[model samples]
Target: MRKIPRWLARAPIPVFRLGIGGLLTKRLVMIEHRGRTSGLIREVVLETIKIDGDDVYVISGYGWSSQWLRNVKADPRVRMWSGWGRGVGALATILPRAEGLAVLDDYRTRHPGTVRALATGLEIEGFTVDGPLPEDITERMPLVRIRPRR
Candidate 1:
């Protein structure tokens, strides 16, 4: 799979810090999480998969080892800034494997092109752009549910 350039991947962070990130919030979200080892605030910009009321769903395309995922697993508390809502208190929960797959299916059905691109980018085999995804897709792309703490 092709990896995003470090600089380019993190470029949106400054925009969020500058308080003009709302423009991208409809499809993206900025999460402020406490680093597991560092115990310091760390930010990451992720694509918004689906929003169901106070819950926001996102994908961990980079897998379980992703820094953001690991950090969130260690400390579910997070601060979010997005169009749906912005708050300093939120919780990150790794959706159940079956549920994650369901969410992935929903996302794929609604945004085929986006899902195709993600599959292609991840170099996932057996996923036809115009057809159903592989059964074990959750291994490559897990879903996380973020919601208000209160």
Candidate 2:
């Protein structure tokens, strides 16, 4: 619900690049979008999961409240930097809420560590925000599938 801090956004770029450069399976991408409110360019490093063919999916524990979600909504045409030196320009489509939930379920089943961390974030005392995909989001969550622009 809050805009990402400028410093936090800028700080992670190098680490992301380093990780992506070092790891083969770990594909970190830089998603570039136009901010819905400010109309300014924004970028975020996201972990991408490749679906069938060129399709890619991203799920946020914060759901549609995240700025990246809003930006994608505002402009589906965006640039994706895959790994350290690869790039893909794609059209991002918001999948049905049910599909998003399904993807999240798959993620949970595949990555127990992620599920546990998310669960802890949701249930722990200090981290009070609802970090898990809520029923409400299952009803209206934005699940995006990015496809290469032809």
Candidate 3:
């Protein structure tokens, strides 16, 4: 799979921020978090893997190196907008590797096409649309579970 350039990947951020993201809410979500160093609000759009009750799950294709992931780690407080609903106060938690793997397994079964695209975009090797993900791939991708603060 071809990887999108960083600039190209960020091009739709504004649209996502302006509530247009609601249209793609089933597959995409808008996250508003504070920059760890700058302490300024920053927003990023990411693919939503699953939603259980109030817990929303997303995978970091760029892993821990992702700036948004790092910011969320520094401060879990955030705002999330998705098709189901929008929350002004949410908490972001990095799931353990095992839990992340479980989520990946379920996501793969539920959204094979999207999972395949994600694997290709992230350049994860040994990924197949019909099989379980390898340990290496799971280890490289971190899963984030976000829920309303209340």
Candidate 4:
């Protein structure tokens, strides 16, 4: 039962890379942060929702333990890329946890179905699913928001 859905969910990466990859090219905002331990540039892609006044926000729904998150914590200075294309250097500001929650709320509203599917897929992938849950679910999850520093 779950295998079918899991396969179906996992099946889209290649297609996305093919069909949506071009659009996603610059869509994936890559943040380059220095490693806390090694002091090297570590880049990770976070999908951006561009906002007014040159602001872009990415909800780290997977939470704060990611390497990128750790790097940012060590050093806020970062270079961003919208896919392979280069982006201007911007400071990485960790949006306050409370504000981050709001951003996640908006994300859920804007992408209800995707949110649900991602929650399930991530759960199957053995990632923590404690931040936010689909309305039908029986748990809560934490979300983080990232905004380009001015």
Candidate 5:
């Protein structure tokens, strides 16, 4: 995918910080994590893949290279905000390969337009928005499930 301008990418952060992200909460979520090295708290707005009960799933199209993904791996603990929710404690689970593929499958089945647009942006070889998803998709674009801590 073409790189997004840094300014455009960071535009939503201020919205979240100002506490108005709920307007798009059904489609987006804001997650806060401790930096792996800096140990400072960082926030990012990510697209919501699915919301099943207390589990909220999202995919890192940038894959493991995404700084947030790397940091989350270092520490599974995180805080997230969605509709009518703010700073809700949660745990980040990197979905297994098979499960990631399954989630992508279901997501595509449910939202073809969104998946098609996302797949177009992803530009991963053998990973189509419609056709059978590649088995290695998880490694290329990791899917994560964030569940509120009980």
Candidate 6:
């Protein structure tokens, strides 16, 4: 797939926020987080890997350097809107390497095509559709676990 420009990457966010994307809520979610420096509310659309009980798992395709990840790391409090429901106060936690790998493995098993396509699009070296996930890919793309606060 061709690379999307920064503006194009976020083009669908408006539709998602308006709840039109709720049809894809099973796979997509809108994350609302505060900016680390500016402290302004920012939103991003992300693909959901899995939802186990109260925890929602997602991957950072851009890895640790992602702005949203940085903001979540600084403040775990966040809001999430998805097909399942809306979470006003969610806690975002960066999962450990082992847990992240497990999540990735499950995702790959469930959505082999998407995994392969993402790997190819991200230029993750050594990632094959049927092969094991490359170590470098894990390091570059971390999984985050989100739990709605009760």
By TM-score, the best candidate is: 5
Off by over 4 Å in 5: none
RMSD vs true structure, all candidates: 2.0, 4.9, 2.4, 7.1, 1.5, 2.2
Report how far residue 26 has shifted in candidate 5, in Å. Answer: 0.8
TM-score of 6: 0.87
Model 6 residue 29 CA deviation in Å: 0.4
User: lDDT tens string, model 4, 1-150?
Assistant: 132353543443443333343455544555667899999866565666434355567645445546677677678787655533345577776665566556666666776666668658565332222455344221133332344555
Error of 1 at 148 (Å): 1.7
Candidate 5 yields a Cα-based lDDT of 0.84
lDDT of each: 0.81, 0.64, 0.79, 0.54, 0.84, 0.80
Off by over 4 Å in 1: 84-87, 126-132
Tens digits of per-residue lDDT, candidate 3, 1-150, equal 345587866765766666666666467777899999999998887878898987889988777778999999999999987764344689999998789888888888887887677667767676667766788765677899999887
**In candidate 2, what are the lDDT values of residues 1-150, reduced to their tens digit?**
334466865665665445453343344556778898898978776655446566778655456667888888889998766656655688888877677777766766677675566457444222222345565554433567878787
- State model 3's lDDT: 0.79
RMSD of model 3 against the true structure: 2.4
- Residues 12-46, candidate 5: write the lDDT tens digits: 87777667777766788889999999999988888
Clashes within 3 Å, all models in order: 0, 0, 0, 5, 0, 0
Steric clash pairs (candidate 6): none
lDDT of 1 by residue, 1-150 (tens): 667787977988777777777766568778999999999999998999999997899998778768999999899999887753344578999887789878887887888898778778877565444666677777776788999877
Instruction: Order the candidate numbers by TM-score, best to worst.
Output: 5, 1, 6, 3, 2, 4
Superposition TM-score, candidate 2 onto the true structure:
0.71
TM-scores for the candidates: 0.89, 0.71, 0.84, 0.64, 0.92, 0.87
Deviation from truth (RMSD, Å), model 1: 2.0
